[model samples]
Target: LDVPCKVVITAPEGEDPHPRFGKVEMSHAKHRNVSCVSCHHMFDGCGDFQKCADCHIDRDDRSYERGFYKAWHSESEISCRGCHKAMKAKNEQTGPIGCLQGCHEAAQK
Candidate 1:
């Protein structure tokens, strides 16, 4: 609900922390000045949480044009690199951020 908030995702006391998905903590550092509605665009008072892949499907099999990739890295206003670059220009110290070198670590494998 606010910047720098810690959203703890927990499971039952004895159960595995990740019965299905692992623990998730939504950080606000990257999006400190951004509003929740910017990313959760479908939220209108109340709505279900939809995964990025739900709408950003790999239709043409092109990594650059893929919905999920484009959604966060293309010409969109909220692109990660775009914002980081801007921050860097402002001397905000967004050190060495890039698609391959930063966010998507699994892609390296």
Candidate 2:
């Protein structure tokens, strides 16, 4: 019910939790003024769990087709960078780091 909540999603032990594990804090300022339905458009019915790459795949014109990686880094309206830049401008202390340290944490090596 609140933004910036710490959501912990876990997988069964020994299962491959490749991308996600441990704990993550939601974007407090990003979703604070919006409703859940804005993003979870299918909340009213049962359907496949939506992944970012599901609708964010690159266009057929060879513009962008790398899947999740491209989508996450894209500066488009739907991508994380779009809002992260704004957040950073508003507050340097709590602003997002695009993908340098946030989602790409594992890739830092």
Candidate 3:
């Protein structure tokens, strides 16, 4: 199967589509070396890829473990922010970890 070359990532519009910043274009090429399971952890190596919003939601009854915000910004290393932080810790090439620097920026390289 062909992975997406780029993806415009935004908050999954769960039943209550909470407020969020602008969509961020993610280049899969930028993460070519990373395993797909690293981000698509929910996938079972079969069937279609499940959208992140499929489980992580913004419902009022959601737990921190399943919250959409936690899915992106959690301390877990698989998250976009978490991965970036890990790379930066090792002085490896990585994206920004701030609001106005990467995800919320007008554009990324």
lDDT of 3 by residue, 32-57 (tens): 89999999998888988877777776
Error of 1 at 52 (Å): 1.3
Score candidate 1 by lDDT: 0.53
TM-score of each: 0.51, 0.43, 0.81
Residue pairs of candidate 3 with colliding backbone atoms: none
True-structure lDDT of candidate 3: 0.76
lDDT of each: 0.53, 0.46, 0.76
Clash pairs, candidate 1, are none
Give the Å shift of residue 97 in candidate 3: 0.9
lDDT of 2 by residue, 1-109 (tens): 3233533322234544445423224554555665554444445545544644355444333346454344444555344565566556777444355444664454444
What RMSD does each model have against the real structure? 7.8, 6.7, 3.3
Q: Which parts of model 2 are misplaced by more than 4 Å?
A: 1-34, 37-49, 58-67, 92-95
Model 1, span 74-101: residue lDDT tens: 6444555565667787898773356445
From the highest TM-score down, the ranking of the candidates is: 3, 1, 2
TM-score for candidate 2, please give it. 0.43
